[model samples]
Target: MTEAAFSIADIPIYGRILLAPMDGISDAPFRCITRRLGSAYTVSEFINTHDFSKLRHYQIARLAFQETERPFGFQLLDNDAGRMAEVGARLYELFKPDFFDINMGCCAPRVTSRGAGACMMRNLDLIRDSFRRLGQAVPVPLTGKMRLGWDETDLNYRAVAEAVVAEGARLVALHGRTNKMKYGGKARWEPIRELKQALPVPVIGNGDVNNLADARRLFEETGCDGIMIGRAAMANPWIFAGLDRDEVPIAEVFALARYQVRAMHAFYPGEKGLVAFRKFIKAYLAPCGLPYEKIVQLMKVTELEGLLEMLADIEAELGGQGQSRFGWEGLANPFEKEQKA
Candidate 1:
């Protein structure tokens, strides 16, 4: 690994690579599979504070994980200071996570419209207040994830970083872009370098880190303690382990996908599980050398038996492979393309 291992509040993180939490994607099944593949730590999906009173089984399922998924945290999102604290206390009392993280970096319109997520950076005082309240209520270490700010006119990432740490945030993950940038513009790492220089706590740099080379460049460029990956991980879960995606064996990829699918079945049963697992079908197939049209057709197989039959056919077709040249990066998400088109 290019970046050496580090820790957050004395909890030794065995590596410098972590899986950034995504709402629908980074659930227990995925997190557990990635942990075994090599990710150092994983954060839970952003749990909305308001829904705590009447959370469904599936909503709470995000928090469920095995002992192997240790050194994990529960990420809470909310605009109200008191509610954030209340949720923090409740999470500790119920889940007893290793730590707590406040979400200030989500840039979705619905989240920002509510004065949460990236919008939190627009108000430094509220950020500090919320962190303070959460710190007081929870005995574990407090951490935060954020973007540059709301936009260029209100770039207060440094100020927010200073405030959160003062209020007891032991670590911070900064996704180097603003709300307006979303996932479009290039992630500016210079500001992340500046923030790392200013903060006393460990800083994990996030944004646009798609592969091992990207991770190395970010660590070298920003000097942050760690790196967090989001979208790219969905394409290649073994990314953090420095596994060359281009050299991955087709059989190995198929086996891993089967394992993850079985895990999904165990966690989310019947059609619900099959429906949820559909999104990942293309991601897994991206590393297989099958034709795009064939892959697209295979991805449409919703029934578990049909999917397994297709995998068996693919395995037989590619019998001579040491490592298939097909890789995770640059593969198209056919579902996303159909939506946009």
Candidate 2:
């Protein structure tokens, strides 16, 4: 295989894999634990800057990263360049992250219909201005995350990447599908490859990078400088560290589920924490291969104690899947070991 065009991302990635910004799921503790597990960087969960600025008590607790997760960044999505710039300037001053990214690739209907995310790509002039304004307003290197385009017919990845560079964007990350495709079809790596070839600034690849093999191939196949993982972190944050088959038992799925429940309680507080935690448990338990009867019972669980009781009981009945002989260097040595397999 050929060498990666850009081995490390903006400034210096420190590590290889990065955690994607998932709105609710990628909370502070989630990012913390996952970063401890493995990841070069963790982009705070994407939120509309307008919504964030308007929050009366906007803590953005997740943005509080320790010195360890060196090179942190926050991703914000907004249609108005002025708003994006205004917010970018504030975050650049307060957080001083390695970079500030504008989300131009979100596929959510509400986000796109309003002419944001991939939908924003339809207007090249606006897209360019968004970058230009942000680049000028923000202190840190300006960055953007975008999709291929509106759809296959309007595959303008090359033009957009070039324009972002022209607008003074230091780097651009491209999700291979159009807004219309959402997370459906296979990610079009060709666009990433094309963008890599078309732009001087580093091009990062996204979409479907649930595992290390996929990540390795993303850089190799597309010539992207880096890979950003979103849904993959939800199912298994360890993917950034090792393959499911190569790493320790996938049985840790249960443990991760339990941890998330406690984290939600700590992060959210009150009865609402338990409620939101339940929604996240669905993905962790998917590998347990639970029967409908058992799943219904587990799903019905509302409180932390109740959920743990059921999972612990299920653990014994399911042959204790988490027990494994595998070892992680970090877990072993703690200091010398860096992130990756």
Candidate 3:
């Protein structure tokens, strides 16, 4: 493929860094911060096809993103071939993502047991038929994200990958773990390489890309077209900006915490906002090297002013350490003789 031609499965993905659709984490507000941070493209959390057709208000809200988050779209999960296409076509017209992604990868107990998500891999006919319908129904390109298989006992990604493309999908992303593995074992990059070798369409690699080095390594090893990041972005939104990886400043951490609280309030309002943002605090403080529990406690506090106060207190505490904590020498004399002139 030409370097200039960057679209994946018809989705104009220029940067090659895709944000994985994480449940409860890849919401619009979080995505906005991440998009500003590193990834070239972003996607919404996996909304069930059944829920989309039903017009679940919360699910609809999840898809609500600003123009700045463009080249972004929603991921849907379903097994019903007829229903999938019908819903896929409607989504093409109504929401208009860069492309529509089908989730054949999620192994959530509820999703899998019901013959959806990762379970689709076990049934070749359904997988083929769904892609066939989806390709025909949606004017947009059809792409799919899938696991290695349902579990260790049934490693069938090769077949599933071929079937999806035959049914009309132009691109495929492999997550490298079976449904049974969940988040357990290491995500096998070898399988991804094999899939890339097998498929004509570009393959995007997901899983275990927790840092720039990991992203680099995956590209080097798999020769996949791109990398998809998830938990890493949740921890440090500045990761993509190339700032934190070089040198993290105390001010940036404090500002991010405050921004998150304000953004949460704007979206969720009141007590829930306060409760919800607590999930993100510890990652922000990883560089500070504080105890995770202490960070979580600090985050759980509801008062926004109280949270800022704690951050200030922590900074003072850090300063008191006299470079011992951060391993950086303090500026002994601010401007000293140089600025005296």
How close is every model to the real structure, measured as TM-score? 0.89, 0.84, 0.85
True-vs-predicted CA distance for residue 86, candidate 2, Å = 1.3
In order, what lDDT does every prediction score? 0.80, 0.72, 0.74
Candidate 3 lands at a TM-score of 0.85
* Model 1 per-residue lDDT at 106: 88
* Shift of residue 3 alpha carbon in model 1, Å: 13
Q: What residue pairs clash in candidate 3, if any at all? A: 38-240
Higher-ranked by lDDT: 1 or 3: 1
**Which regions of candidate 3 fall more than 4 Å away from where they truly are?**
1-5, 55-58, 243-246, 291-297, 312-341
- State the lDDT of candidate 3 residue by residue for 194-250, as single tens digits: 988889898889888777788888988988887787777777666666543435566
The TM-score ranking, best first, is: 1, 3, 2
Candidate 2: where are CA atoms >4 Å away? 1-10, 59-67, 245-247, 321-341
Order candidates by lDDT, high to low.
1, 3, 2
Q: Number of the top candidate by lDDT? A: 1
What lDDT is reached at residue 259 by model 1? 62
